[model samples]
Target: MAAILSKIKTEAEGTLRLLWKKIDPNDLKPGDHIYSHRRYGLYSHHGIYVGDGFVIHFIQTETKNNVLRLPKAEKFAHRPPCPKCLYDEYKDLGVVRTCLDCFCCHEEKLHSIRYFVYGAPRVGLLLKKSGTCTTLVSSRTANEVVEEAYELLRSQGFGEYNLCQNNCEHFATFCQTGKKLCTQMSFYHDLEEWVKRRIS
Candidate 1:
């Protein structure tokens, strides 16, 4: 998906922008839900933009080693015991903050999804792609969303990462909307079942 964030754009020529809008790196705002395709859209990773060129996200321990391979952010994480950032502390699967450069480096292109979309709920259905836009509205403010992510990272309250039950998308959506759900996982799960039924 070719999506980026500047602000919500609508259908109108000069109005707010909607789904799949390509935006400059400077456009991302705090608490914005962003994602990127992984393995040719087999799945997408999700995270919350927490301002100051940083993003908060949930990662599995095995993947953490891979993430560490990315070029370190300007002001975060030294090889061992970086005093400025919490690189050493997040040893297992849980929330951690990293610069946008490191987060976006996981994939070739980064896409963003929005919670509380402007148009009707049916729009989301039409999009058909999970980890994109959602019709549900978020009750929390952007700052509140950012705060929730920080709180979770600080407290390690999200629990172990589970592909079926709990995952990164769940962590991000929860912080943005206070709801823990992963449409991406559900989308694939249903597709798998449908394929099984089709053949057998």
Candidate 2:
């Protein structure tokens, strides 16, 4: 999709500035909701609109070699706060721009969905068992899966585990080996018998 945030209005035109002295990184929230058509990707709601340029957001750099770019904002509420300096220049204007089209949100969704059952409790249960992090489900690589889960572990007061390069190798090998083993096992299993009967 396009990187453009949203439709800008003439009324919203003016010099706008943002300061993040008080805002914490954790303040960023997801805007995407369940069951909405456009709710798939754009997840987090926090964004920082530094004037004279584009709005800023953080892409979570993952341990598994992926980036979930989040929409970063200086002012985050139901409505964008009209700064005092911008009021004179843009008070009479219409909506200039909105914080949307978040790449991080989209990426986060991708990371979440790859392993988890879409919007299911089983997904969380499985991920928790497999030591995966919680993210918006969509499509993502296996490495991003475990790494995201590890982040969650840390946040939950679990002691930070040393990130080892071997973990990456182990992850790739385990996934590959597991798939191969399952494929091999399927040939001797009841699933194969069921498929053969359906075809016969």
Candidate 3:
């Protein structure tokens, strides 16, 4: 049993090492945009790393009404409600700061179905571009960007979470630049193009 447990631990560590290799710990700076897409290719989530192994991102939390409803619904149904069903019924919670470990631990916990990391272009491109294509623009120093993000997080203090106008990507970009933008918009736009191409 001891040998079996040791082998399992070794395999888990090895898997983590492989995952970490994809991301350079040295390159992670405060205010840096970290993004990942859902496994189904529908959407993405973004956050600003605030250094010291923490990330600040907008998260949706269940509303009081929904919380109140769950028990009654479950009692009536004679079984627990589906997690996805509960999530669909809940309201947005808002911005939150969490350790990177918790943030990336599991997608379902975050209410994301599944997620995989991907490289994001420089913050400048995201700020300056209003369309699918990217263009260079003036960039802030890393320190300045990080400070801005921290300040915003402090000032905002968990405001509403709006998927279209305000979201995790908006929060990250706002920290990097004073602009609010959604990266998922481009994904949707591209998807629209793909569908149009297929139909036409």
Candidate 4:
């Protein structure tokens, strides 16, 4: 069991490095953190070192816009290969470097939506139709959420929206006041619940 876990870790790292090299060969590194240009506060940690300019990292398959449809489904199981994996199999196209960031989407406008939280990191944007909102669960200060929210809204084409954080008697209050952001676990759990609730 221990050996298997270790091997998995090693493989994960190698995969991450290869992915990174394909994206930003010059700036990729193991253990390096990255943020989405569209969503503030959402970040992925635990990059793998593939030496000689390569790194691999994990990214969520779904975001808030695309909530989890099947919660019990295993991650990375039975799913089609990602662009990195595909590129690895066929490197003759020279697609690795250019398609790293966008995964060869070729879409000029790439927007990352903040759809879920897994850990206690207050990173990434929580986007909605009205505007984009930032998580406030990581701060004790009541103003932090508001400040971040304002910044988030402004960044997401809501320049005229006023930022306000209201202390709350309930969950929505936290969002209203930006009082306390939930831990990533809490956010994830709640997000899943929300998905279930909405779908149900």
* Candidate closest to the true structure, highest TM-score: 1
Question: What lDDT tens digits, residue by residue, belong to model 1 across residues 82-136?
Answer: 2444444336357888776556544335444333232235534555476655556
TM-score of each: 0.71, 0.16, 0.56, 0.22
Output the lDDT of residue 190, model 2: 56
Candidate 1's C-alpha runs over 4 A off are 1-17, 62-93, 107-120
Which regions of candidate 4 deviate over 4 angstroms?
1-25, 35-53, 58-99, 102-185, 190-200
Which residue pairs overlap in candidate 3's backbone? Answer: 60-93, 61-93
Clashes by residue pair, model 1 = 8-17, 9-16, 9-17, 9-18, 10-16, 10-17
**What's the lDDT for candidate 3?**
0.54
The lDDT of each candidate is 0.68, 0.26, 0.54, 0.31
Error of 2 at 176 (Å): 45
Highest lDDT model number: 1
Please provide, for model 2 over 95-187, each residue's C-alpha lDDT reduced to its tens digit, 9 standing for 90 to 100. Answer: 122223221223224222111112223323332312122222434354443343334324432222222321221222222222111111222
If ranked by lDDT, best first, what sequence of candidates would result? Answer: 1, 3, 4, 2
- lDDT for residue 132 in candidate 4, whole number 0-100: 20
Query: Candidate 2 or 4, higher TM-score?
Result: 4
Per-residue error (Å), model 3, residue 61: 6.2
